[model samples]
Target chain A: MLQCSRLSFTYEDASQPSLKEVSCRMGQGRLTVVTGPSGCGKTTLSRVINGLIPELYEGKLEGECLIGGEPTTARPIYRLSEQVGSVFQNPKTQFFTTDVRSELAFPLENTGVQPEAIQERIDQVADLFGITQLLDRDIFSLSGGEKQMIAIASSCMMDPQILVLDEPSGNLDVEAVASLARILGRLKDRGLTMVLIEHRLYYLDGLADDFLVMKDGRLTEHLTPTAMRGLDGPSRQARGLRALNLDANEDASAPASVATEKTPDLLRVRNLTYAYHHDQAPALNVDDLTLSSEDVTGIIGRNGAGKSTFASVLTGLLKPGDRSEISLNGTKQTARERVEDSYMVFQDVNYQLFSETVEGEMLLGARRTDLFREVAQKLDLERLLGRHPNTLSGGEKQRVAIAAAILSGKRLVVLDEPTSGLDLLHMNQVTGMIRYMRSLGVMVIVISHDQEFLAQTCQRFITFRQGRPVRDSRKLGNLLQAL
Target chain B: MRPISIYTRFLLVIFANALIFLTLPTPLVLAINIYFCSFQVIVGRVRKGQAWLLVCLVFALGASLAMVFPENLPGHYLLFLFVGVGRVLPLVLVAAFMMGTTKVSELVYLMRKIHAPQWLVIPVSVLFRFFPTVRHDYAQIRRAMKFRGIAVTTGDMVRHPMRTMEYIYVPLLNNATNVASDLTSAALTRGIGDPGPKTSIQRIVFTRLDALMCALGLVLMGCGAYVAMFQA
Candidate 1:
């Protein structure tokens, strides 16, 4: 079991504590979920449990954290690692190896485990995760979900008593989340105490044993799975929690065809194909498609399904094939023109935000500054104008990017996974921004694997498979099931 | 031929480093580059090895062309630039082959077997794993720069040097900072800092093929050294 008693921590340079007297006890063989809005101390608590608190990030720690009856305080991270295994949010950063086989063998190798015993453990863990085929594969070739599974498998190679997963499903799609739930369920059945820190709650409907809600660096509520499931919309919203239950067929009746037809200004494309290399097949091949400038369209696909490639091509960051055509309202536009007319907010907003201040970022490469004040006010970035882009929260940085896009006179804006790794409050904020962008007559294309964000924001859905749109529908709920 | 041992590759890399300074005969240089091209092909970098081979051929041709020109002829400096980079082309290719083919586990095991300190082994392994991620992040940063209408051209750099440098370095540094901490956390949590003898599942002993490759490298180095000392 994992236990925390009056835990509070402040970073070395931080003025305020990230975790404020947090207390919780998670039972063995049960999966306890820790969830809250951004900066709510859930991650800080996980760090405390994993012994990365005072060990790695030097902080003023005032707490008692125990994992499997062992106090985490005063112990080295490696010693605590023997009791608690940690899987971080970002799959790309956690891995220290280049191949699956080596990654699986890493933790064992570090602790002076014998080569033969390590190999045996690798085989057993791989079998447990149903990842035997992935044993010999390169880590880069695997999908986001597969990489995450390997991370879990590698962490479990030591057969630690407790497992801590921080937002493992942050980058996964609906199908991947389902697969993750199954894997976690298997781990729970094997009597491994699990702590999952996540904002996505629907997939954990029956899997989670308890839900611990934290706000303002304090544990606000602890509820059983039954009570968490029974939370109404208003109650969930007040707690800043995501929907506990996601029914794909609940509201499948709203067809977007009517709105799409009413909008006269449409961006049309013909035979649009883009290949990363000459000899290989096209990564994006949309033969014929029309997008309404008034409708917020959601592009849903698995990782490497060309959703991002399509966004790049559409935004003119990438050139299409020779026989392709893209026109706005019957007027053909070249790639250069498309570049001037569209802007894309990348998945990692850190890359897009180049300026030091929000104000400077808004006018970074703009041709006009007349809309700057209005866009800033609308996005609620007025008071944050002087603050550095690096200091702002993830959602604030995204809004700054959007504000910059709008101020630059862009009519088409693309947000690639804007709400990923974001809590319900932030996701709702993004949804509201998408609606606001649509109201301002900007065509929004959101490339996402987040079903809830898409359902709340987009009017039409385009599902891509094998580098092409296989299903274009208004019934997001129905299309989600198929995906 | 099967993949050669990483020890062979490491020996060849050191040999190539020495060869870079020595004024080897032209034919010997060409032969070495060709051997490395084939070595790369054996190691599954089919296209990269061939591309480097083609580049070396161009460099050799350009170097010969410059040799035929007068001492102070026009375009001689440009040709000389190619001559310099081209002279070490084979070494660069060898280094790439080593990085591309050698796994982190193999390298770590090799270091441990050699009785290297943990401080040296950890950083070297981390540096080896950091490059590919940096490359990926750099590609994204360039795309983001293009999307934001920041010109990523030489002309733009010359005109707005500070802004261009800011555009490139800010994101790169930010990602590096984040990845560094996250990577350390990951390494520490997995008992990478345990004060014990570290073991690895990777089998990293030299094979018969490695002996052959090392002998070849020694012979080549001897020939190059003889030429540099006597002929030059």
Candidate 2:
């Protein structure tokens, strides 16, 4: 069992304690779900449990945290790694190897485990997590869900008594979330202690045994799933808790603006085939494809399955082969000829930002002063004008990129993985921006693995597999089940 | 007034530097050179106070040296500083400002507008995108090192520079390979090599205000050039 007695932690630079007198005990062989709003110290608590708080981060501690009846202060982080393994929020941030095999072996090697033992554990964990096919694959080439799965599998290979995941499904689609839930259930059944910090509560239905609600770094309540389900009205202060009670039927009652309808085709691709080099396999291939301007389309596929490549092609950031043909607004143009008519908001916003200040960054591709002013004011970027581009947070940078793309006055805009690191609030803000973009008669294509985002925004779904378009469906439920 | 193309802007800056080099006295040339070279902190349109303060200090030092030293000694010093600072600093400052303010798309648009060869813009855009990826890869490698108990201290870096290079280069090369593929696809999709004048939505027209500014700049250049010719 894990126990904390009046645990309080204050970072060196922070004015107040992140966790204030937080006391809780996680029982052995039980799954606990910690739910809270963004920036409420959910991640901090998870870090503390894994002994990263006082060790990795220089901070003040004013309480006793015990693991397995031993004081946590007595053991260093490396030592605690044997007892507790943690998977961070961002899968890419924690990855140490290029290949999945080496990635799975990393933690074991760190603890001086035998090579044979490491191999044995990797095989067992791979089979357990159904990642055997992915072991030889490149780490960067994995999809959002695949990467998260690898991260979880790598942590489990450590053979820790407890596993702590910080929003494991935050970047996954609905289908991937279901897969994650099943994996967690399997792990829970095997008697592994699990602590999940997540905002999406629906996935925790069968996995979470207890619910721990945190606010202002303090544990406000520790109730069983049964007790929490009995709460009446929307009085449940936790945003995630309220979302759990939402019936599937209520989703249909939402305004028509929630799921736009497919209108006339605005962009069409005929025999679109693209390859990086003459010898390499084609990055994208489509016999005949059409996209409507009015629909919010969700592009779902495994990593390297050409979702981003398609977006790049659509936005004129890439060139297709000679055999490839594209028609935009009934005009046939080669890939190179269509670039000026499109805009793209990149996955890494920093790559496209060349200006010193946020204001200058927004004006990078803008032509009209009037449009610039309108976009600037609408995006609330006027306040951030004087600040350096690099100084803004991840979500702010994303918004600036979106504003810039909108100001470019292109009829078509492509957003690639725009919601990767955003919190709940920022995610809402970004979705709102997408709506605004759509309202301007722009043909917007969103490339994301976020199922909640797709369900809340998209009306049509397109799936890709093995560099080929597999399915195009108008029914959201049908697509979710298919995936 | 339309703003000049990037090529024109590049030439204009070169001309301005040449004029400054010719008209200013040996001491002032050295002062201006040092000022521009060390004024990296005062980039873009904003006036950074710290950079301005540093420029003033350098100016005072140059002036004192010119006053106290003999003509030959100060002339040699000024000549050396001028070559180092004056010849290189202005170009560096101009390049920095241009790069720091111009987006890759804007550059692509301008290049396409001027009918620059596809080989030129394609390679340049790829290089531009490569820089940020390289920086990100370096950071990832550093974090991976820290996790592996390899301290990236200055002493360690100095002792094993080759190892440090390996640490950065290996990951960088790996990432570059992946990014290159993505960039190629992106470039092709955008119809980069399509025939005819590419219509850019960027709309970089030379407004009346831009023309007036360019005219004033040209007049300044003309005066500087005449002064340099006569004074010499």
Candidate 3:
């Protein structure tokens, strides 16, 4: 069992405690998902439980956290590793090795596990994660979702009593989330304690036994799965929480603009094809694809099924092969030309935020400053103008990237996985920004595996398979299930 | 079913690099050094050809200018740059190959096998992971610069030198600053500091290819030494 009582934490640099007077018990053989709006102290509470607060992050701690009823303070962080396995938010951050095989062996080898036994464990864990094939794969070469799976698999290889994952599903597709949920269920059946810090709710369906709601440094609300299931749409929305259950038959796909009439295609591509190697079949070989300024188009597919590659091609990051062409407003376009005409907000927004301050970032390459205040206010970035872009939270960084794109006066904006780690409030804000952009006749293309976000924001959908668009959909449920 | 031992590969790189720099028989040493590079590219699939570009740049502009106009002031300077830079490319090629092929964990495995101290092994392993990540981050930083309109071309650098430098370094520093802690934490969680016998999944077998590469390196070095002592 994982338990914390009267837990409070104040970060070294900050005056206010991030987690205040929080108390919770995660019973053994149970899954507890702690979630809330951004900066709600869910992460802080998790860190305290995992013994990183005073142990790693220099911070004041009050009250006590016990893993398996023993004070976390009783053991060193490395000693606690035997009892609890943790996966952090950024999958890229925790990895120490260059490839998957060594990443798995790292923990085992550290604990002085026998060589043959380590290999046995690696095989067992790989089989469990359904990633035996990925053991030889390069860590840097994996997709965001693949990296997340490997992160989980690496953590689980220790076979700790408690598994604590911070937003493991954020980067995952529906299929991958289902797989994770199944794995968590199996681990729970084996009497392991599971504490998941997740933003998405739909995938946890029957797996989560309890939900802990943290709000502004306090564990304000706790609900059983039954009570959580009773939350109506408006209440959940009001609380800034995702749907407990979205109706399968709901038609949240087509945007209102699409109902009115069709708009002219602002972007068009003919015979778009790209391949990494000479011998391999093209990862992408689309004959023709078009997007109109009328609605926000969502590109939905599996994690590495070429959605991001398609975005790269569209944004002109990846140049198209010969005998292939791209055009904007009937004008033939090169990669540089396309890049000049468009902005792509990468999934990891860290790369896009270059300016020291938010205001400085907003002022970059802008034609007009009149709309700056309104955009900033709409994206909840007004309060962050004085802050360094590097110091902003993940959601704030994402918003800053979006704000940067908005300020750049680009004709087209492509957002790749913008809502992956964003909470409900920020998701709504991002969806609103996309709508605002669409209303202003700026063509927006969103590449994401977030079905619900797509259901809310996107009017048109294109599903890809083996790097080519297999079909178009106006229904997100089908897209979610199809993969 | 068997791959060459990582330690054996590292030894070959070190020995071959030593021979190249010794210049006992300059041509043979150069051939041996370049062969190791080609072996990495073709067999290990560690293809980083920018080192080749460096060689071309040094030889084409520097060496050719020196040869064509040896008496001229510009030729003298070019010759100085050529001789200074030309000798370093072979070693750089070998370093790149070592980095590209050997992972941090493999290095750690070899270090423990040789009973290296933890402090040395840990940092060395960390450094093996560091260079590749720096290269990746550098690319991202460059891409971000281009997208953000602070393109670091010669013209832009000349115009806004400080801003261009800021654009290049600040993002990289900020991005990788916290990576140290993350790496430390990851290493800790894995029980890296434990004073215990470390184990690895890699089977360190001396393959035929390994034997062949070692033999070739030793033979070339021996021939170079013989020529250096007696013939030269």
Candidate 4:
């Protein structure tokens, strides 16, 4: 259904082509998995297939792309969209409507489908995706998993024959990932063609008919199901691919297990709760929590479960309630006080980054030149010191954030979903930073949903369910049970 | 009653904006604003909540304040505030209905039905998607700043204004650009364009409700004009 011949695209103002002489052909009803390290032109290749390269982006194209045996260059995006449905990486950016029903009806209404048949199609698609209950729900109120499901279902709602998904699993939980895999299987059974551009592969291991590896802007290898299964961990590492089973990615967490035993609680919490609105129900209600100085604590929870909110309170960014008591080093602190004592590296990392350059960012609110240089070197960001923080890649930006936090002499560091959307290599870089922070006697707290990262890196685990903190007695087992 | 057409809703909102500069009576202004809010609730678009109650309270308070201090500058200012809010409420009503009840595709369909210029309507339609994305981005930026020990406050504004602006602008601008690019790609791939006969899942047609609402708005405008010229 889809074919790319010697497809090469050079973005305007860029010296080199983002996608080199690469080619891919996906048959109808077959799912192709494309894996590579970050900046390996996976997104570019998918965009090319979806006709966004030469269409939306003003890039010079070197080859022809065919959809259903017809050249895509001569067709407008709207025409191509009839056959090709594209779901982007970020779910929030793609949504134009506030509610689910409207979101699903978006494309159909755009194509001038009659209202009666529109409703009929909406029902059919919602039923097909098992999201009949979500039809009327508000889009923003949904969890990340649900939003992604909607993005995918809405993209394919008009019964498009070919669907291109870019990192659909980037923000999903393991259960969500499994459900996504199941949904893909259902679509495949429906005889719809699919191209999944993903870094998270364990979920796709069984479902994908072919695994194609694109490295350094080239299709280096293509592996079958049996070949992918027999591939070893080291070889996977060398190729910059994620582990088939996330629990086995112990490159960063396994060796760092030799750290010291648990120390006394450096932070204490009692009855920490938050309600987004006073008239609404409480979003979070944590009874008691403790943080030790000598252990790397990981906070794990499903999306929209208030784990990040709890981190905000722990790091002093969000002030605890008047009745709720929280103490850092046996002294109570307000939001501003927490701001001074602890530093949090946020999930986006773009929010905390305001400096023009890396050195400027690390030097903010401090004159610790020696400390800044030392932390920068330790985080392996010493070379990017002169580069603009905005221009750095995802992993580089994250380390820059961490290194800046350490330079400011904050003993307690909290990272919220730092390894999310990162490839295996970048994931290790972030995991490594957390370990390094712990080694320096900093009370490091990490909040994430990555099961492997939590199990392999954390000495203590705290889980949240529906905004209520659950004590994970058996580590990640409780997490799996929660799912 | 049947629902109103999105075209009528858009026209009503623009008319309401024009009515802002008119010198309508305070009570008449409040009545019209309340009517728009009530109309939205009647259509089952926006839920009647704190927002509705607050509007009612503001109208009541402004009326009483005007009564007690009709000649005083402060009282007149309060009345003007009421008028200002009254002028904006109808626009809010239209926005709420558009964002909640009408799908983006439906709006585009209505725009084309009226033969509105594509270059103009496309951005307006895309803006229905843009503002929400901007709001989401703004919240993320706030969370990220809070994480980095940077807090925006009156004290910071007073102490280091330029530095404070720098801290705020850099991330805001960067994220804004990123969000815009991502949104453009997503929108383009979804086939948001001037050409091609786009289909609609939500069939938008003129109903009696549209006629009634449009007539009511025009009648209100006429009454306000007469009251401003002769009665007030």
For each candidate in turn, the interface RMSD (Å) is: 1.0, 24.1, 2.2, 2.5
TM-score of chain B of each: 0.88, 0.64, 0.78, 0.74
DockQ of 1: 0.77
Model 3: lDDT of residue A103: 90
Clashing pairs in 3: none
Candidate 2: segments with Cα more than 4 A from true spot: A98-102, A114-120, A123-127, A130-146, A173-176, A226-265, A275-290, A301-306, A463-474, B1-232
lDDT of each: 0.84, 0.67, 0.78, 0.76
> For candidate 2, what is the DockQ-based docking class?
incorrect
Count clashing pairs, candidate 1: 0
Report the C-alpha lDDT of model 2 over A217-254, residue by residue, as the tens digit. Answer: 88888878877667643455335343454344236421
For model 1, what is the alpha-carbon lDDT of residue A242? 88
Instruction: Mark the 10 consecutive residues where model 3 chain B has the least summed lDDT.
Output: B20-29
Could you say which candidate leads in TM-score? 1
The deviation in Å at residue B93 for candidate 2 is: 35
Candidate that beats the other on lDDT, 1 or 4, i.e. the better one: 1
| Error of model 3, residue A324, in angstroms | 3.7
How far in Å is the alpha carbon of A167 misplaced in model 3? Answer: 1.1
lDDT by residue for model 4 (A1-483), tens: 788899888899888888888888888899999889998889989888888878777778887788878988778887788788988777766787777988888777666677788788889989989999999787877877888889988888667889999998876776777788889999999998999998888777778899889887888898897888777878888999886665555343444344555454478888888777779777778787777777788777777778877877776656666677778778877777777777778778878788888988888765346676568778888788899999988788888888877776777888877777889788877777777777667788888777766766787777788988766543455356654
By the lDDT metric, which is better: model 1 or model 2? Answer: 1
For candidate 4 chain A, which ten residues in a row score worst on lDDT?
A: A249-258
Any runs in candidate 4 off by more than 4 Å, and if so which? A247-265, A273-287, A321-323, A366-369, A466-469, A473-479, B1-8, B40-106, B152-169, B204-216
Q: Whole-model lDDT, candidate 4?
A: 0.76
Residue A355 displacement (Å), model 1:
2.2
